[model samples]
Target: MNKRAIIIGAGVAGPILALQLKKIGFESEIFESRSEGNTREGAFLGFTPNGLNVLKEFIDLDMLQEDCTPGSIKFFNSKGKQIAKLDTAYQKQRYGVETFQLKRANLNKYARIAATNAGIKIWYDKKFVRYHEANEQVTAYFADGTTASADIMIGCDGMFSEVRNQLFKEVSAIQYTKLISTGGYAKIPELSKPLDSIRMTFGKRGFFAYSVSNNGEVWWFNNYFREQQPKPHEIEKTLKTEIQDHLASVHKNDDPLFSKIIKNSHEIIAYPIYDVPKLLHWYKGRVCLIGDAAHGISPHIGQGASLALEDTVVIAELLKSHKDYETAFRIFQSERQARVEKVIKSARKVGNTKTKTNPIAAWFRDRFIGFFIGKQIQQLDWIYGWTYSNKNSH
Candidate 1:
């Protein structure tokens, strides 16, 4: 009998993993919580060189390139003073691939197409409720009262994963970083010049990042005011106050694009930054966790999406090369755990700077970051330089 795998959650990792498994001659079925074919609620995501390189094997790079903005990252202070600029193109020269800033909905659509082209069956509205693994087969139960059994189960079901909770009695608690993030995409009615660079401004109150995403939409995120919880529909309800306060404290004056983007945003999403402490083991028996479920890195380094992309390819490769699931699972954790832990730590350190509780600490943190901008970017070379080879490079 042919090997069959069932994946929960059809987000970045799940669908990408499905395609990779199909290439390795394994059959896969993806169960997603949302309804089919609707990739709305647009958001922007940056694909570092490492992410783009791995994804190129499964999908067309040209299609992805067609919908991305290739640019360098510019860092600045609260007074609109330039700090240090970093070259994203360095990844291309070092790794033979370029980083891209794309819209989240566009990337999701492309990954879905890749999975479908690989003949993977994806069922929508099949929210994962529970699962059971026997000696030979693993059975997954869904909230829709449907059940499917496969040889192995992989849960790519994002940060709040049902599969991870069902398998482990105590799920690793997500630590609240106290920082609230507000982001939305909108058209640039006018620009001082044609936007071609990504900019990040660090202020006393918080930080703001802006970049042009695919389809000529400007995507911006403001992170500040460590808070307990967000109000229901907080993005729409509190965006005006939040953006105004952020601008008032930082710039002390209104700018055209910032004001227009925040006021005119049709869909704004607000969420607190939560991270799971690194887990020692990512798999048990015939089941394994991937993406945010396995390791929820803070978005400070902008590596969450890239990490998910890496997890999908790594998990698929591990399953193909190892005969025994036990050995494969252990090796997978061993090989990836250190690298992921390092990234999680880096992201946490970065997020911590934005949330410095003490005034003195905040000053020191800002100066520290400004001083080491180049060194920090260089440290990421190990991550952006990684490649998936037929043989284990580690």
Candidate 2:
């Protein structure tokens, strides 16, 4: 009998996981809490070569590159002096894929379209409440008074995952990282020309990064230190104008270009950064967690989406080789836990640099930032060069 899997969440991991499972002759369904076609939830994000490789299995690179731009990052200090740079062209030569940046909504749209074309069923507005395991079958209960039973249940529900909460009963697993990020899109006439690389500035007060898309739109974000995490209501009620004014003030001491970008942005959004701490386990019974549900990494390294993509590929491959669902889930955790934890730690360490520092420390950082960045880039082969091979697992 073919194994039937019930996937929670319709985000990046869930849909892609469904497609991968289908390729291996397993049946799967995706349940999402959000309504269909309403994917405009976040700002733009970058796709590293590792993540792009997993995506390319299902999506054509040319189709995914539409409206996006290849991203080679150029770093600058507060005084607008170049400090370091990451060459995407060189990255392509080494990793077989170039890093690209695009709107979050566009990526989700492509994933959904690909899943639908593959004849996978995705149920929207189905909020997962809980699940039960008995008689070697796992059944999921939704808020809509419906139930779905499958041979295995996988959670791709993201950072604040309900499935994760139900599995471990650990409401405190997700922790705030004492950082807030705000970003927006702007159309600057003078800066309309597209550049080969994105510009990132370690400003006096915060870290700011911006890139020009293929269509001449400037996508930018600012990461700032906040001692206290903002209340959810506060974030929701804050007006775009208020955020713009605050960001402009934050970067006032830095280059004048940041001020111009903030002033010209038509809309702005803000969110607090959060990450999942290490868990003792990622599965129980026939239920397992993948993606952000398993380990949530902050945006400091731009690997959150990529890590999730990697999880899907690994889990799908493991399930294909291991007939026992429990063994498959166990091996999945063993294979992924160490690498994912390392990424989380790296992201946290990098995030700390964005926080407020003393004058001496700041000066030292500015003076030696390029050297540190160069060393880090040299050590990135393990990250960008990772590829899954089923033969190696046995």
Full-model lDDT for every candidate? 0.75, 0.85
Q: Model 2, 1-394: lDDT tens per residue?
A: 7889999988888899999999888899999998996776767788999999899989887887778866788988777888888777878788888988987788888898899999999999999999999988899999999999989999999988999999998543677777777788889888798878889888877778888888898888877556777777778786455678878998899878888988988767677788786788899899999988988889888898999999999998898898888898999998888888888888888787777557787788878877887788787777888888765666
The 10-residue segment of model 1 with minimum total lDDT is 248-257
**RMSD of each predicted structure:** 3.0, 1.7
Model 2 scores worst on lDDT over the 10 consecutive residues at 170-179
Clashes of 2: 0
How does residue 286 of candidate 1 score in lDDT? 92
Q: List clashing residue pairs in candidate 2.
A: none
Model 2 TM-score is 0.95
TM value for model 1: 0.89
